[model samples]
Target: MISKQYRLDELAKQVQGEPVGQSDLKLKRLASLENASSDDIAFVNADKFLDLARSSKAGALIVTEQLRAQLQDVHQNFIVVANPYLAFAILTHTFERKHEQRGIESSAYIHPSAMISDSAYIGHFVCIGENCVVGDDTVILSHTKVDDGVEIGKQCFIDSHVTLTGECTLADRVRIHANTVIGGEGFGFAPYQGKWNRIAQLGSVRIGNDVRIGSNCSVDRGALDDTVIEDGVIIDNLVQIAHNVKVGANTAMAAKCGVAGSTVIGKNCVFAGAVGVVGHINIADNVTVTGMSMVTKSISEAGSYSSGTPMLETAQWKRAAIRFKQLADVPLTQFAKKLDHIQAQIESLESTFKLRK
Candidate 1:
């Protein structure tokens, strides 16, 4: 938690922005427009929020070129960039909390066969199992468990209470948040006679570089092969990625999303919050599934997709539900014939009215 300070010109260069009006202003932190102080920097990405940004007491503001014109009267120092939000994102990393501790704690348990890097930080009560490989500058925080044969790469930040089991292989710069369970057994079972027999999860999880998995998530081990999470995949909290699933590069799954086993989701796809995908489906690249949808089959196109009816009033929804079920009772041919008859009768009445006119 070291204090960080940056000048306006330096941050602007990092974000590829043009610093205007007092380019030498010092910014101590990044904050929201409503909460920023004279030593902080705020950002406004949209015109609707420009009014709020204009009233902010921040020492500097990150604004897009489109918004910079209307903010001419604002007294704060300005950093004009192509995308204000992107500039803010770049600036946030410069001001974020840093991890400075670089040594193993006294209470940690390391197996004799484990090979831990000299520069890695093993926090309080952490356990490293047999033959585990911990790379350089990796931080295995307090109470985390690294099981046998686990291979963790350099500069990874594994938060407290997380479990890495089943000989999972994680690449560099991976950040798994607190309480997440990696390499857990998937929901695999075989129906035998009148009972369910448990199927063995014989595989592990292979995660690529720059992946960020949020807290409370379960990425299950495969039934036979590895569950692969490609590079730059970001998963939010409470999400479930089942066994043998291949999440392609740069894919993002928001909170509460679930992808069933054996699903091959292509690169750069986005699964919004509360979305559910069925097993054994192939989702094409660049597909965006909206919130609260259930993907039952394969998606072959690349576009934004949605399913499920919008919310309605309780009584209205009940009536719609009843009518929806009643459709199963009606024959399609009979309905079409009745509809055609009604259309013919309406056309005859319109012709008669036109003759009278």
Candidate 2:
């Protein structure tokens, strides 16, 4: 924890915010608007929380320039910025906790041919296989496995119980949370006479820089080609990425979402929680899928997509579900007749009005 205190003017310079009234007030930490004290700084990001901000007892506040006037009469110190939320994000690092671990543990097993940097930290029960390369300043936590021909880049944080299988590659600053399995065998099988034959997984997984994968997520190895996760992709917990799936740069997938085999998702796409994407499809860039939706076909444009109806009472839903199935029995010819009858009635009314005039 950070015990050092900073004046309002110094903090304003760090985030490029304009200091308003009383720049000499000292702040020790950052806190929420409702929980701030006289020594803490707080932020107001939205209009709905204006009342909370007004009532906060924080010595210093961070707010947008547009809302500065609203707080001006309150006689409290503040820093005005173009974006208060972004400024708050920058301030979080000042109070962030650092878990500093150094040196290789005595219980770790390293192969003679494996290369590790002097600056990296290897924890207890770690297994480094032949031809593995651990980069500088990387931290591999306890009970992790780094198999043969694997290369992990600099400044990565691999949590406990992670398995990086043979020949897999991870670029710089990639974070893998606890219990993640990378380069696991894909779901592949061949049909034989009255039996199922297994196909060997020949390819590995390649992850680009700055990717963060959450806990218990499984990224499978490809059957013939590599399964690629591009730069800055963020995956939530319990997600599944199957064989030969190519995810473009900066895409985000929420928790419990699964992408089937050979699906190519474009850049800047967003998949909400529990969204399921089918196999062998291409999704366009900048697409957004709502929560619990099923994507069965390809999206050719950049837009938001959703499926599944809203929830209703159980008894009401049961009746609506019955009517939904009965829709197939409705006659199509009756709709055509109704349209013709309406058109004739309109034409007769028009002719009668003209004769009266």
- Which candidate number maximizes lDDT? 1
Reference-based TM-score of each model: 0.93, 0.90
RMSD of 1: 2.5
What's the lDDT of the predicted structure labeled candidate 1? 0.94
User: What pairs collide in candidate 2?
Assistant: none
Colliding residue pairs in candidate 1: none
Runs of candidate 2 with Cα error greater than 4 angstroms are 328-357
Task: Write down the worst ten-residue block by lDDT for model 1.
Answer: 67-76
Clashes of 2: 0
**lDDT (10s digit) by residue, model 1, range 212-325:** 999999999999999999999999999999999999999999999999999999999999999999999999999999999999999999999999878999999999989988
When superposed on Cα atoms, how far off is each prediction in RMSD?
2.5, 2.7
lDDT values, one for every candidate = 0.94, 0.93
